[model samples]
Target: MAAAQDPSLFLGFDFSTQQLKVVAMDESLSVVHQSNVHFDSDLPEFRTRGGVHVHADRLTVTSPVLMWVKALDMLLDKMKEAGFDFSRVKALSGSGQQHGSVFWTRGASETLKNLQPDQSLETLLQDSFSVPASPVWMDSSSRKQCDALQEAAGGALRLAHITGSTAYERFTGNQIAKVRATRPEEFQKTERISLVSSFAASLFLGGYAAIDYSDGSGMNLLDIRSRSWSQICLEAVSPQLDLLLGDPKPSSSILGPVSSYFVQRYGFSESCRVVAFTGDNPASLAGMRLQQGDIAVSSYCLPPNSREVKAVESDTVFLWIADPRPALQGHVFCNPVSEQAFMALLCFKNGSLTRERVRDQCAGASWEPFSAALRDTPLGNGGNIGFYFDSQEITPPAVGVHLFDPQDVQVCSFSPQVEVRSLVEGQFLSRRLHAERLGYSIIPGTRVLATGGASSNNEILQVLSDVFNAPVFTLDVSNSACLGSAYRALHGLSAESGASFFDVVKNAPEPQLVAAPHPEAKEVYDQMLQRYARLEERVLQKSRP
Candidate 1:
């Protein structure tokens, strides 16, 4: 494929759990058009199941290979419906939810053909005793596998040194091992193991399988420095897992053109360049235009730190803080759970949706009304309400550790209007305390840029600001992950721009609102934080071995 002229139009897909978003941009990176396609929740088979229990409140993991084809088909159909020409589309790439694994049998042309057909794809991807459905980043059934991998690789510290992460249950390495141990027949038949992002790219560009470093880093199998599969770590796990692993590629390498089959089926131009893919988190970071000293926090139910808290096996909620500087400097910390200087994050498992539910149930109540009621209530909701927001577990660590007992987790009766505020305040304190404990300065005057679904709510922003006693800025972009993915793509294209990531962020759009902390509320939150600690201890004691 020939290189396109400068300022060409690029199409980006944000492949998310609930929706597939497509954005069109010129080479200068101004968004021209964007559309989102939501999947029908009524699909019976799409419902999550573990034994007889079913989860209705969370995103159900589906096969990436299947989702990719469906998403592209949907995107193209939508584009054509909107009168957008496929031939004009120059570059095509995506950022998918990271760490999930996909495997294809080597030299199995029959299986590959079956996988591409719309009707056969779903049938082939469904879970079976042997061929299991793709384990998503949200899946946490690999604790034993994580522990076994850690031990096999010597220890957690050694594992982190090689993979830039400790063995995480949702990570590709542990998930592969789990399959190998639990479903030996399927494991024996597996061939190329790939991250969801790369897997999607592979399907689009024919059978070529190569992952970007950003996505590879999340797998708990790649050496951060070498940016390749860790042989030592791989040896620790069953060698069969290695057979499924592929080499890592940079974020910008053009893997291939759209395959002829894809072109014929989808009416996509053969000239469209398919770039290597990245994980959603790093892509979101790039989307937010985050720079040194600028922190990007995903405020959805699985706040960014879900992974970190699970990694430490900590009883309390924590954030996944990524201080890129440490990795850039080649300095590795002993504790993978600890936050590095210039970066601190706090993740709450129960995020925006909880607040939204509370808001809706308490009809006609604004976020401010909800926050005020929470403020009036004493710290820890006057020790009456204990909120445990572990809707879905984070990766790298196992999940289903008891987060709360409804009977033990009590909440003081508050006005429906203020219930949302109380929840937000509770999360604020949870995050602030954890950040402080992880050696972050957490000075009352620090500024934090909040992003994600929750960031848009003014009331939640104020509550967080008050709890942190700092300035809380709400980002304008709701899908920062998509923006970050584009940012990475743009950065890759212009190497000598001599612009730091921070500079890129500075040029981006400004936040709509900035909420300053309330001085008096700080004292109340501080007192409440202490009670939260005690409550956390009490709750965790039940699960202690």
Candidate 2:
């Protein structure tokens, strides 16, 4: 560790779906220590296959809140056993899987505030929840609730304008409405509701933590423009909803100090500040240090009541406060670091896992062969294209893998190399297509920051650069959510004293340039983009549920 004078370490926690992870960062932004507790193996008693219970219907998903509590309990013990110096940590923040929520029973707040140093958190908070299983992001069984929500808000467009999203099956508002409709007695017993992110923060703060605006945007209940709960939306969901969800705060909010339980039991400093946590995606955006504005955000300072939102006219239009109009699909969340800014997130059912699946099928189940296959294929794959969505894709709202020949005719499959190229090219094309619809463009001199499992591959990065027609840069971070939370913690330390998130993380690691767009990239892909879009429309007809 550092010499006595330099004990300014910050801590970040990521309550991901399958694991409870913590990363310690020194003042210089270097990750000093890392630890984790995987729920499946360590807590086998929960009987969670992948940290969740996928219901019989195969759409609804939930996780035991106690499993998370116990995981945190185990994680801290492991850290202590590893001789981690908690006293040196100046601040702590966290991020959790988005849209998941924990329902606290009446008076559970008191129990949280008075957590006993002598007892384990799982034991003390065992009876604290009115709902033992929290609905998670993977859940897609809220169709009825979602339909009601859309009708209640005038229409899908109005609702999307108000909440940054239209009715989504997995959003928290629909999940809450489902619980209220199905379990009236249990709803009454529930005194408060915390999104997965705030629930994690509450555990550390020893009190209920307000939902951060960034994560709150996922709920479809918060008024995105005003950054508060929308009464119209709440009235559509349930009564006393405002009380159930406490007013949201900025994501960088400093809730309070670490609880006495941590201080006494884990030797944590009493001064360790508890920063408000947010959705994992928002935290990742922060961790990515993703920058906005080439054709947008002319100034950081917006005049009071000024229009912060602009509409992008893409395949599906979403509300964003920017000057550039782009087409898109996916969610637009408030930036965790800046209230005036927003972040665009597009997800695919066929993301890393699907990519890995293709690798297994065509490349001897190894990235070595996978890269070679990708390199062996031509830039446009002889004008053939594919749409691989093993599950439902959010952007295109499609499912299953569909292939098209050079003539745009339906096909079964291609050579392994062609299959590899199809998956990679189609994926990046989808991102660029939807992002343009979201009011963003790969402007001149634009550098695409790449991360996650795929970014490590030079071949993948090269493809990414060619597809976007921009330079691709990679940040050397293991977990963006954890590191971003730690970065937020340091920001939280000085939030009230007027420190900005940029100022706090200005000295953080720089992204390394990995790939530059090929000179012939635009010529190679321009016509392909048109063909892909036409094929996407054709695939959408087949893939829609």
Winning candidate number (lDDT): 2
> What are the models' TM-scores?
0.70, 0.86
- Candidate 2 residue-wise lDDT, 1-545, digit = tens: 85567658999999988889999999888899999999989999999866788778877889999999999999999999999999999999999999998999999999998999999999999999999999998788899999999899988877887887878988999999999999899899999999999999999999999999999999999887789999999999998799999999999888989899999999999989999999987887777766653211000111111122321111211122342231224677787887787766665545676787899999999999999987888888898899988866668888888999998888998999999999989988887777666566565556677655666789987887888787877766568789999999998887788878888888887778888888989888878888888888988887655
> Taking the candidates one at a time, how many backbone clashes does each contain?
15, 12
Question: What CA root-mean-square deviation does each model show from the true structure?
Answer: 8.0, 7.8
Error of 1 at 519 (Å): 6.6
Local accuracy of candidate 1 as per-residue lDDT tens digits, 131-250: 446777766677888888888767876776667566766777788777777777777766677777876677667665587776776767777666667787787667745556667776
- Please give the range of 10 consecutive residues that has the lowest summed lDDT in model 2: 297-306
Give the number of the best model, judged by TM-score.
Answer: 2
